[model samples]
Target: MNFALGRYFPADFPLHRLDPRAKLLGSLLIMVGVLGARDLPALGLLALGLVATAALGRLPLSLVLGGLRPFFWLFLLTFLLNAYFTPGSPGPLGTSLEGTSQGAVLTTRLALMVLTASLLTLTTSPIDLTDGIERLLKPLRKVKVPAHEVAMMMVIALRFLPLLAEEAERIKKAQMARGVDFEGGILKRLKNMVPILVPLFMSAFRKADLLSLAMEARCYRGGEGRTSFSELRFGLGDGLALATSGLLALVGTIW
Candidate 1:
């Protein structure tokens, strides 16, 4: 129910204090660099960077690992599918290898991607992150894609995440009080979730309704020339961060 899907990193770290523009840009460079990586060693390097950055953010190792929980099966499935299905060389070179290498490559790639993404959320606060993102995408306005509006929508979504989490937590406590143990086995837990999910969803809809009304009352229009309270600026620290990430990208590309 912790809807804060973003900001995996706790605040107070030096990285956490950097401008959102720097963080967003650095995160993009890392993601693009890692995802573009074709070789295993380069991918491994990307993973290492993610770990180091996460440590820099001062997040708990357990929290980092926990994010990988749901993806365990995904990793496994990716590996299995790739290993068995990635058309391979026949004869002695092929060695009839099925899921081993392909699976490993796929899983490794996915893990690195996830780690990189998680690092972004861990370090950046929700509001500033979205604001930076919107500002970054502002250039896309020429195409009439409504970049600002989209950004506002994303901001709203991120803002509600923690609130929704609290609501979910409340629902969970209420269910638990009724002897609905959500800690049971899979099916049992799923069955128990019905009570919590139903009410939580209803509450979310209600909240959404109220939010719509609130926005309407405030005369909120689309993000047309909407100025931000905290303007994003790139400082020396931001430059250093960007340079570091770019250097990493360079290394990744050549390696």
Candidate 2:
């Protein structure tokens, strides 16, 4: 449950109360804007807006920053690769100035996207997300899409993500206790992980079997004529969110 991305933090803020559909739409717009931003200035503005939105959601600064910890090395590697390898005019530091600039911009764009997406999951519950996705994909059913089943599978995957993380942590600790050297060379570390991964896979399979059996026992069926316990309603806040998202998208496009 301590894993950052899929964990939802309950709060009484406006973002938490927004209809999932509105939040999903806004998130899509922001993602598009971030992906298309052509310069650092545009990214900076989008980052500022995301930070403000997180503040409005009452999310702690620590939570926002911590969400990107797992990707720190990935970001660094991307920056180094782009900075040194990209063909451009050489800078005083022996790296191409254009490459360095592009690397920095790319890194910032990815980091901002991760932080912004964290806000969506932090404020929205898995159930609400599932429902919203099902509703959105309902139109696809005309093409024989199993919208409900697809949504259910997505929700189940999200629910299991944290469980797997926790299990990995526990397995790591147990291996470390038994003198496994997990911090040596890359190959050595990978060899050390064999013991952990084998057991983890076995455990995952066992859990899957049990879940299947439990669902069968309960006579669980796919979504058909399903009724929701919570009704989704669009309000003024949703309208504002959509308008703001559209504005951000426009600015990013023009920048």
Candidate of highest TM-score: 2
Instruction: Give Cα distance to truth, residue 33, candidate 2, Å.
Output: 0.1
Q: Give the residue spans of candidate 1 off by over 4 A.
A: 1-4, 7-10, 87-98, 156-207, 213-219
What does the lDDT come to for candidate 2? Answer: 0.85
Stretches of model 2 off by over 4 angstroms after superposition = 92-94
Report the C-alpha lDDT of model 2 over 208-231, residue by residue, as the tens digit. Answer: 889889978988788877889888
Candidate 1 residue 115 Cα shift, in angstroms, is 1.8
Clash statistics: count for each candidate: 8, 0
Candidate 1, residues 1-255, lDDT tens digits: the string is 423244345579888888888887887888778767767888788778877887887888877766676467788778666665667654233433544665676688788777666666777777777788887887887887787678778767756665777788888898878888888677898788799888988999999999899989988886765677777778999999888988887787678
lDDT of each: 0.75, 0.85
Alpha-carbon shift of residue 172 in model 1 (angstroms)? 8.8
Error of 2 at 116 (Å): 2.5
Report the alpha-carbon TM-score of model 1 versus the true structure: 0.75
Q: Least lDDT summed over 10 consecutive residues: which range in candidate 1?
A: 90-99
- Deviation in angstroms for 81 in model 1? 1.4
